[model samples]
Target: MTDGEIPVICSGKGCRAPARWRLVWNNPRIHTPDREKVWTACDEHREPLAHHLAVRSFLRRVEALD
Candidate 1:
């Protein structure tokens, strides 16, 4: 929302809110154990997005954005 600041946009569809949390995930069927994928999320979308990944057993961790 300002100059020199890279936007950490939420991964939720159509949402433009800045990210406050990081969702770490990976599909074991297609990715190696060491491979980790990430999805950025705002406070509002964090639960929903995390749920989506968690249901598939792909969610590894949820961490607050630094």
Candidate 2:
């Protein structure tokens, strides 16, 4: 998507803000590390989402969408 384009909402519980960060992740146990892609989280929910993903060791990297 283009810059400033509203991203898919955070997949976290009850979060509804437009995503601002794109998190690239992959589950090595289930798939090869080469299979990676992005998930979005809004500014307000970014930290929580990142923390949750990190706790599961699912986060590979994160970048601002715009």
Best by TM-score: 1
lDDT of 1 by residue, 12-65 (tens): 999999999999999999999999999999999999999999999999999999
Candidate 2 runs further than 4 Å off? 1-7
lDDT values for all models: 0.96, 0.80
RMSD of each: 1.6, 3.1
Model 1, which residues run further than 4 Å from truth?
A: 1-3
Clashes of each: 0, 0
Q: What is model 1's C-alpha RMSD? A: 1.6
lDDT of 2 by residue, 1-66 (tens): 789965578766788777778888887889787898677888877787788779999999989876
TM-score of model number 2: 0.74
Q: For candidate 1, give the lDDT of residue 54.
A: 95
